[model samples]
Target: TPTQAGHATIFPTGTSPGTSSVVNFAPGQTVANSAILRPGAGGQVTVHLETPMAAGTAHFLIDVSGWISTSGYEPRGARVETIEPVRIYDSDLSGGNLTGARKVSLQIRGAVSTDGGAAVVPPLDDVVGVIVNLTGVNAYGGSRPTHISLVPDDFDPNVPAQQPTTSNLNLVPGQTRANLAIVPVGDDGRIHLFTLQGETRAVVDVTGYLVRREDDTRGGRVIPLITPFRAFDTRLSDFHAQPLGPARAEPWSFEAFVNDVKVDGEPVGKQAGLLGNFTAVDLERPITWYSPVRTHMTIYPHPGGGGEDENCGAPPNISNVNLGEAEAVPNMALLRYGSSGMGPNRLCVFNLAGYVDYLLDVYAVVLTD
Candidate 1:
């Protein structure tokens, strides 16, 4: 037999380059040998056997022994809340060691590709599942979380997340799942990023990825993409309207008046930009905090600025007050209020319910600070 097919071998570490050989195949039939794989310093060796595979009928094994860091799993679907892997700060809650009285924000960026690529938009009415991890710390310096409070950006203050009413968690250290799950209703192709913070334990950030719908579609390899949009904190002067009393003890409310409210020295001014349902997060993502042109509805305690006096009510004295230039930040905002009312008076606030919008409310009252 002259040789059904020629074969060659190389011994770089031993003797010759192409002297010794192994004849390992027959003619008219394709063949492949498992490769001899070894670990290298950030390196690899691939041996390509001259073989032709059938229509999806080929298998080979390559043994590899190497060291690599463990990667955190990525989550997906309009992520209302997500954690980033950046260690922003660390504090020792022991010995009452306060770490500079800081406020943290949390947010979930929309989905992104694994390779930091472009955004992918799925079909409408397609629902994606979401997950949240509540990272904490333990007494033994282990990884865990104490408590987590998740509030969606579009939530009504009357209906917020359930907090630990008694003020703490009742669990042994190191035994808790740091996560929450929510399936929101929308087709904005966004990730539900949740902003979070902690009082006692250490915290970890979250990353997100997505999975395809469960419908019977063609199964193929698709890459996930992240379009991160963050939510920052904003200081709302009169954020809360009256707490919708009878339902709430001290009814917290918000309101605005026509001649009663003036902005930039103009009656019925448009200077008061509404901070409609502002949201904050301990995470670092960009959020377009909505600023209202005019509040939902306009209400007043007493018209003519003295109508409340007949009811034994003192007129609201809002003077010397000037709202500084309106500027928006990641998680914070500023609105200046000074005194410009009739006399040194008392101001009562109300939520904007009967006056304008369904979700608007007047929340605060300051004399002249």
Candidate 2:
């Protein structure tokens, strides 16, 4: 039992003096979030725990879904390329609701853009995986819980793919919720989605994709950590025990080292981007007449110099997390770090409205080396 809010951070073992990944848990709430991470040369990682209350006031559990690696036959390595998020599938616009155990296939290769003429993604042969935001709307499971599952279309290409025991987004009745998922792309360049225990309208927006690197100098390769690591929690005293006020932006530097030693060969200061899970917790409701207050947060590369003017301008229309009052919403983010001269290796988080505390758990780092 937690007396107060707490958090945990996981990172490559020996990497100290850095706060890149983090997850927060509040009293009476058990939250589970996941991220990809790159391990140290020793093939191990470290977990750090903290709380505003007593030490050991919080408990944690870790799980590994799977892993990825490259074979010698491949030319160059696999790298991540992010783009403006674009909607690829929406049940409401296409046909109808997705019922229990029914799967829908969406083309990842050469599909028509859905975000009013956003650029299309590369062909299937160039892509190995895709990062998408999955949302569930108006879900009803009657007496059972409802969940959504996503997988490559080739899981069983000949017929409707079976619903896996796992789930990406779990929804409540009459409520809309969203989650992030990274699914592999099959040779057919399509993916399949299904609902379990109820029917719901589904929406998928692609944020980025993993592709075979055409050149080593362009994109960054993803390095999965041994496990998800919590690197920052606003509730912790050492991390500033305060909630982010409405319409405020904060800059965070990206620093990672192994064994308290900085290696020249590692991507340390050369990080191209990071793949982290961002959560909004303890949301302060607005004083409006709206039944459920809604807000959003956006993250972008920090323009360097660190002056007073180093704040996010209008905040792009894109959002990393769409949050509701009193709801702890978590979303995966694939954010590029600032390049040379422009706040190198840093990012800025901007809160659109309402006050909220943040938790960041890192699962992977994209290296440009």
Candidate 3:
């Protein structure tokens, strides 16, 4: 401790991401400082004052990195944690008895990251509304906040300050819960949704809350909804290449399967895999079959794209292939096809291998379109 070393207050509520604000101490004191870090909190950030010690004025700047966790008491570097911008008053530091502890909040302007590109500032004037709530009252004191305000990011003390406007925001206070809602304006002049919950303030509470609510297992089985869309463009024109000898090519066929299905039955569909320039209608007519030859068939790891995987399967050449006349054009939207049966369809398998689980990541039928 220096000759004039005094007590310092630590903000349990760290700043938000994409913004920067400063914290100051005795104006001219060269205080030797070390900040404790708590993971997920603003990671061990401290500003060393360089000037001579001022009797009772000192401050430091804080930057809100958007990726920071919005939890209560989120340990920053070692033992540090950040407070929510709106919940700072409820923070433990807010009630501490430090003699000269005071912080000034400010909105960041063009706040840029070292590695990230140029920063994009949110529209402050376009903020039209806000609402908030809290839950899990437990044994804590009764909730108290009735209203809230958001100061301008460019507010200056040197100039006369204007009244900070308030929006028609709702503050629902419940015996066991609290809630907030804000209609933040976007660059496109549209209102976006913003909400905050008190349960997500700290790590332990959040883990317990999520496990009790989302991970509850009481029913026999549950299945999430699947989007009715194709993952990749497996149409003819998409795979069409240079012309081949006219030997009356044969049509290609594909089969798909699903296992360990419980509730929503497996996916069903007649998906048109890979085809040269021929459409589904062309399969109506057939011609002489030519001798099958081995060719390179690259199966992408993902529907849209992916890197090559050597362990997937050996490139197998499909023979006795057939070609038909061009029918209907392929739809860019329905790049791949799926149907009830005998197609890009869904299949179900009730019993699965014990202690074994398999997830179908990607399955492609490559053809020379």
**TM-scores for candidates 1 onward, in order:** 0.20, 0.69, 0.17
lDDT of 1: 0.24
lDDT, candidate 3, 156-271, per-residue tens: 32242432233211122321122122222223333211112221110000000000112222211112112111222223353342122222221112342222212345442322
Q: How far is candidate 2 from the true structure (C-alpha RMSD, Å)?
A: 5.9
Please report, in order, the local distance difference test score of every candidate based on alpha carbons.
0.24, 0.66, 0.22
Sort every candidate by lDDT, greatest first: 2, 1, 3
- Over 283-311, each residue of candidate 2 has an lDDT whose tens digit, in order, gives 78555554655677877666555444455
Clash count list over all predictions: 80, 20, 80
Best model number under TM-score: 2
Model 3 stretches astray by more than 4 angstroms: 1-104, 111-142, 151-165, 172-369
lDDT of 1 by residue, 2-21 (tens): 12433322122322222212
Decide which is better by lDDT, 1 or 2. Answer: 2
Query: Which ranges of candidate 2 are over 4 A from the true structure?
Result: 1-32, 38-77, 111-113, 138-144, 154-161, 214-218, 224-242, 245-269, 287-294, 301-319, 322-327, 338-346
